[model samples]
Target: MTLTESVNLDNCDREPIHVPGHIQSHGALLAFDAALRLAACSDNAERMLGFALPALGADLDAPQFAAWPHVTQAIGDFAQRSHGTSGLAERSEVQVGGRVFDLILHFNGRLVVAEFEERQPADREIRPFTTLANGALGRLRLQRTIDDLLQVAVTEIRSLTGFDRVMAYRFRHDASGDIVAEDCRPDVEPFLHRRYPAGDIPAQARRLYVINTLRFIADVGAAPVPVHTAGAEPLDMSWATLRSVSPIHIEYLTNMGVAASMSVSIVIGGELWGMIACHHLTPMVVPYGKRMACDVLAQLLASNVQTLLAADHAKRIEAASSVRVQLMETFVGGDGLLAALRPHAAALCTTFAADALVASEGTETFVHGGVSAAAGAELLRWLRSSKPPEGLLAMSEQAKLPPVLSAALAPWCGILALQMDDNRHDWLVLLRPEQVETVAWGGRPEKVYKAGPHGMRLTPRGSFDVWRETVRGIAVPWSATELEIARGLQAELHRAGGARRAQVARDRDQMLAVLGHDLRNPLQTIAMASQLLARGADSATVGPRITRSSTHMARLVSDLLDLSRLQGGLGLAVEPKPADLARLVREAAQDVTLGHPGVEVAVEAPPQLQVPVDAARVRQLLDNLLGNARQHGEAGRPIVMRLEASATQVTLSVANHAPPIPPESRDRLFDAYKPASLNNSRNPGGMGLGLYIACEIARGHGGTLVYEYHEPFVVFVVTLPREARAAAAGEA
Candidate 1:
């Protein structure tokens, strides 16, 4: 509705008209009970009560409802009634199905006023002033995330007031109440989807609901007040006796079998909205002062709601709409998403605090942008080993993270991660490390941590201010609106991604195009040369040329396949079998020497040192290391291959006369595309995947291959288990 249209009452035919004078004098009243079922009462009683009330079918002479000493005395009083008919009434605090009423009496004559009120437990513990304030703020923090808001609010209320069942009650104009939300104490009956009738809470009683919005009712058994007439000039209702409660209302509760109930109206902007109801099967009393405090809490909550909603709704919607599109676009940019987030690495880390990472499950690839550069390798290893949860995470914390992360991210202080999955497409993650105090540095969210041991002494507003400041400094503040926008944006991006799958396919074509141009031409030239040699040109010349060309082609194919398997998630084929470790070492050394006749190669493999392995893959592994040394090391220096075996394992070490690997390249030795030489002369005609693939192949065979830095020489070691060696020994 337009704002102008809303305010223009003249055009609003259905809108209720309000008179300012009536609002001030007796408060505005909206009629609730217009429809009445047929019922009969005596003329005098009808005149007295001002209405033809329903039949309850009972005498007025009962001792509880009247002043009869016993049932017999009440019968005697009934017998002495006048000739005209008297009023009929029923009172009960027990099981009588249908609408129950309480503390009822009938005088067989017309009454002056028929007021309505419910009996309540007189003693309720008033929450301390400090608790109310602290709790209110705690609720605010809980509301930072969407899913947590309702849960946190319910938990806080249940804990503060100790209600058996504390529920967030919602009301419709028809005078009915439904439990919209509830937080039941442990072991209590779950009330999640429970519904209740509106007649349970009468319209007259609802009008007075807000007075105790923050009240505490301790016990209902001890209520003290002088019974007084309704509408008496000085009628005092602060107590039970001074104000007459409706007999029908009491009967209604009794029939329902609820002994004691406490309700605090949740008023937003001084207007009645709904309520928080605490119901117990047993009677209880709440002290007056405590009740007042509860009212204050209700007022505070109402004010917050009012503040949040009072702003121009359009302005808020517009602000949210503006950024949502871009946020979602950033979330689902596919391969480009990671690159797009690189600049916001710090922002992402601070937002999630931890549990932040950028990953491509499609490629089994992930980048830990939140971790330090020194810790990237470690973080990657962690990501490879750790599994992410399914679907988009609405909001989850690291506390529930699997135990494995602790060992993996041990280098960093604390760890946190949050992820959003794009349908089934990809994942967007935010990771954080403890020492990376984004909270204290950002000052975005105002947080209130639970008070320390000293209850009143350590509120967020008081003793914990210093710690609050620290956390506040590090946490990047994201408003609820911001999160909503981000969520909406992510959803949009997911939709866009579905629409752009064709574009993405085209992009993949572009990648293949680049790959063909950059890689296939050289391979094809070598293949042509090999084909010419095989055509029987010249044995001496073409024989070696054929071998060289074939080896080049083999290397190219091996690199391509290994890269494909790594990206494809197809486990490498590794056949571990009995083989002579000594013979394999000598053969690999001889192979490298044949390729480089200028370099001297020596093997020191013992005849008894046999290992179970795939001989050809092992030979390739050693040849790669030795060939790398010959192609990059000093020509005349001896390249030594050493072999040793333990009872359970065998080790092969190859050392060449080369300077120690540079410090910068040491960490990335096994990383694909990271050659030892940036100028591309380190291993002429070599692809950097040689070392990486060799490492993977060794791991596949349940062994490890690594390089160690030794001054004037770089040593590459391959370690294999004794089972492989024992099998080989037995075979030999």
Candidate 2:
């Protein structure tokens, strides 16, 4: 009956207004009248905006409503009925505040009725030149080393524009596509390692993923591409959703839902290589500029992928023919082919963060990188299971690997499986992605799988791994230039493997020799010290001597243990603070003097020369140098000790009257088990581990321990590189 009720009826489509009894009964009509007028349309509606839009009756007297400059002048006339222009209907789309609206004007009786309909911002920028340049240049850059090149391109773009998840969605022969490279959400599990089957994306939808170089579905629930076209001809199967797709797409998504999706195709050489997919958990309406920026990013990625892949193809030829020929001489029937190709692995394959050239012999495998035998076994199992009879098969599903293997190889995210033989000569060159987020696309819909009673079930658009292309055939024909490079690499790896084996043997021999000789001297020292004490000397004299001898003996044992710990990769536990060098020097001198009563040990250090050093290690260092000087150098010459402190380095030099070491020997004087006789000591007691251990200790604290072969006096200097005095002062 009232204006409010009339308006409500129109919206409700003949249904009665459902106002609550409690909110009605009194002054309802008055309150509802104001509410109905206010709610007739949006605040900007022409009917509600009288100040901005002149009343229909006042149009003749009112200043003519200034036609928007974007609209055509004259507007074709709204009041020439006799001239057949009165019934003219005019409608155009207008943009205001990044939103588009359909502006319609109609002549009714003697007045004009104007209405506006909201239109989505689905219109694209018409920059044919920009698009052409991007498409052309982008495709060229992408084909080089497609794997690493795409990853880098995606990473750089993602950084430039912050996107939650970005990926490289690669197309397959089947209509479906998979996200091969991805930078995923921080808390979510990585989706880099799995392949999505064709069923994952419907045939028609996938066609769009490839054809539509840049497609944005802002809000799936709101703006949908209508499939109905009255005059359209029969759709070809190749077209994406040309006819009509089921509502199941929305239901299927709602079941395993993605709220928003933005896909940018990676087209190389006019063929769709892949797409950059950006996803969102909640509904998002992307800004026009943002979408354009992503399109530009995709163009860059496409170019890089093409460039890099072409380079890879060339490299593969070089490896298979030329490199293979060279490898034949060294490896024969062995898996040494992969070992020969390692030096170029970094440059040739940039997607890999770390790599290993592993040789498979039967079930057993040998690794050339820093992998242990146990680790090698795990790696071999993975490669053998997936590798082809010949050539390479790249795998990106490292995260889904077994716990043991994945735990050990947590650093690498991908693997390149290459088979060299039917027997005991298969090789796996593993590749680790630099960061988990490098290859991600910006518009891949998030897939969430529901957890079942047994375990998690993978659902459509749910979290899973992805791999682009895993080629299983041999290198497709080789060129002259390619053969030469491959052969060179193969030869190089063969030589390298031999050199590696030789070095390992030499290291093993050195360790064994050091162990045998170093272990014996301490036992001998302890036995001699015990024998001397057992002889008939006064308990007062013998007891002190025995203690002093035992102290040095204990020091030998401790040094050996510490050296073992360092060599075994255990870090030193340091509790550093300010320490006085003079006090430590005096204490070390006193300890050295306890055993040798006849020798006069003197310390010439400044009283207040303070330095930051590990007190225990410094004391042991001074003790060993002084002891070596007394036992090997001229016993009569005073073991002069001087401590010098500069702004950055604290130097403790111990000089003794010993023959100058040979130039060659000086370089290796601090090496473990190197004969101490090089310092002109006839009786170089204790293992050569003393200086070696000392040097290790010094370096651990950002310092150096070097032996200077000064004429007549070989000086062992411990230089501790420290923060500047000004820095120390600042901290203080």
Output the number of the TM-score-best candidate.
Answer: 1
Q: Give the TM-score of candidate 1.
A: 0.42
Residue 567's lDDT in candidate 2: 46
lDDT of 1 at 39: 17
Candidate 1 structure quality by residue, lDDT tens digits, 1-732: 111222222332222211101111100011101111111222233232233333333333323233223322322333344222333322222111231112222222332112222223332222364466476656655453322443455556556555677777655444445456687657765555444445355343554454323433333332322221222232222212113233232323343344555667877544457677776657654333433445555565565555555453345556556444444445444234443454554554444434455544342334555443324334444444454453333322234444454445433433322333343434554444443322221111232334333232111222111122222112223334435544664566556656655564554455445445545556665667678777865667656655666666676677778767854555456677877878878877776667667778988878756577888888778877777777767778888888987887778888887778766676567654442332256554555667777776676566778888677778889887867422112210
lDDT of each: 0.48, 0.50
lDDT of 2 by residue, 512-609 (tens): 56555655665565576578767865667556555655665676577668766754445344444578878999888887677677666767888876
lDDT of the structure predicted as candidate 2: 0.50
Error of 1 at 703 (Å): 3.1
Give the C-alpha miss distance for residue 134 in model 1, angstroms.
Answer: 14
